[model samples]
Target: MKDLPADARPREKLLARGAAALSDTELLALLLRTGTAGRGVLQMAHELLAAPVDGGFGGISGLLHAGAEDLKRIKGMGGSSKRAQLVAVMELARRAIGQQLKEREVFSSPGAVKQYLQLHLAAKPHEVFAVLFLDAQNRLIAMEELFRGTLTQTSVYPREVVQRALQREAASVVLAHNHPSGTVQPSRADEALTQTLKAALALVDVRVLDHVIVAQGNALSMAEKGLI
Candidate 1:
C-alpha cells in the first residue's frame, strides 16, 4: 500500500475528498491499516470481505458477528492488535446507534425504529425476535431481544412477550425480527405470531403498533400493509 502515490492512499483520499467519496473496500482498508507480505492493504481488505465466513459475502453484517478468533482466521488479520481494533470499531458503531435510539421518541411511523433496529439486528446470522417497549406518549421504555432460534426459525412466545411488557409497564410496543436470507417479506408464521402477540398485549391494555421484518437493507411494516 505504501508504494501507491500519497494521493491514492485510502487515508489520503478520505482526508482529501471525505469518507463519502470512498468505496466500502476503501473504508475497510482504512480499518485494516496494513497488509501481509505480497498483499496490499486494499487487497487484504477485499479478501477479508470476500471470504465465505457466513456463506454470503462477509459484508458489514458478517463483520458485526465476527469474533477475534474469526478475524484471526483472515489471512492478514492474524495479529491480536488488529483483531481487537476491528472488534472495537464494530462495538462502537452498535453503541452509537443504541444511544441515538435512546434519545429519540418512537412514533407510529416505522422509520426511526427500522433505522435503529436494522443496525443491530439485520446483520444477525440467526433468527432473533425483539421488541421496543414504549410509554403512553410513545417514548421508548426499553428494547429487548425476547427470543433466539436457528437460522430458519424462531419460536416466539406471546405470553413471555406480554409478561415483559407488563413488567416494564409499557403502554405500547413495536415488534421486529430479521430474515438472514435478505428478504423483508413476512411469512405466514410471522403474521400468526404478530396476531398472537397483539392479542396478548391487548389483554393487558397495551397496543402493538407494528411488526417490522428487517432484511439486509430494507424493512416491511405489517401495519402499513394492513396486516396488523
Candidate 2:
C-alpha cells in the first residue's frame, strides 16, 4: 500500500475528493490503517470482503454483525486496535442512521422507515422481531426489538406485542424483522405472525400500518404487497 503515490493514498484521496469519491474498499482500507507483513492494507481490505464470514460471503453486512473476536479472524485484523476500529465504524453507522430517523417524519416517508429498519435489523446474525410504535398522527413513539430467536426462526407472541403497544399508547405500528439469509421475501410464518399481531393490537385500537422484511440492504413492505 505504501508503494502507491501520495496522491493515490486512501487518506489523500478522501481529503482531496471527499468520502463520496472513495469506493467501499477504499473506505475500508482507511479503517484498516495497516496490513500484515505479507499484505498491503488495500489488499487486506479486499480479502476481508472476499472471505466468507457470514451467509457464505464476507460483505459489509457480515462485517456489521461481526464482533471484535470475529474481526480478529481476518488475516490483517488480528490486532485488537484494528478489531475495535472496525466495530466502532459499524456502531457509528448504526447510530448515524438512528439519528437520521429521529430527525425525519418517519410515517410520512416510507422510504425513510425502510432505511431505518434496514439499518437496524438487516445484517443481524439471528432473527429479531421489532415494532415501531407511532402516534395517531403517525409520528414515531418508540422502536423496540421484542423477540429474538435462532437464525431461522423467531417465536413472536402477539400478546406481548399488544401489551407493548398499549403501554406506549401507540395509535399505529410498523412491524419488522430480518432474514439473516439475505432474502426480503416474507415467509408464510411472517405473514401469519403479522396477522396474529394485527388482530391482537386491533383489540386495543392500534392500527397495523406495515410489516417490513429486512434483508442485506433491501426491505419489503407487506402493505405495499397487499399482504398486510
Best by TM-score: 1
- TM-score each candidate: 0.87, 0.86
Supply candidate 2's per-residue lDDT for 121: 82
Q: After superposition, how far is residue 100 of candidate 2 from its true place, in Å?
A: 2.1
Clashes of 1: 0
Look at candidate 1 and tell me the lDDT of residue 37.
83
Tens digits of per-residue lDDT for model 1, 1-228: 678898888899999999998888899899888888888888877877774753324677667767788787678777898889989998887776666555666664357678777766887778888998888778787889988874222467787888999999999999989998889998888888888888888999999998988876788888889999
Question: What does candidate 2's lDDT look like per residue over 1-228, in tens digits?
Answer: 678998889899999999999877889999888887878888888877764743223667666777787776667676788888888988887777665555666656888788778767887778888999887777777799998985222467788888899899898999999988888998787888788888888888999999999988689999999999
Model 1 pairs in collision: none
Report the error of model 1 at residue 71, Å.
1.5
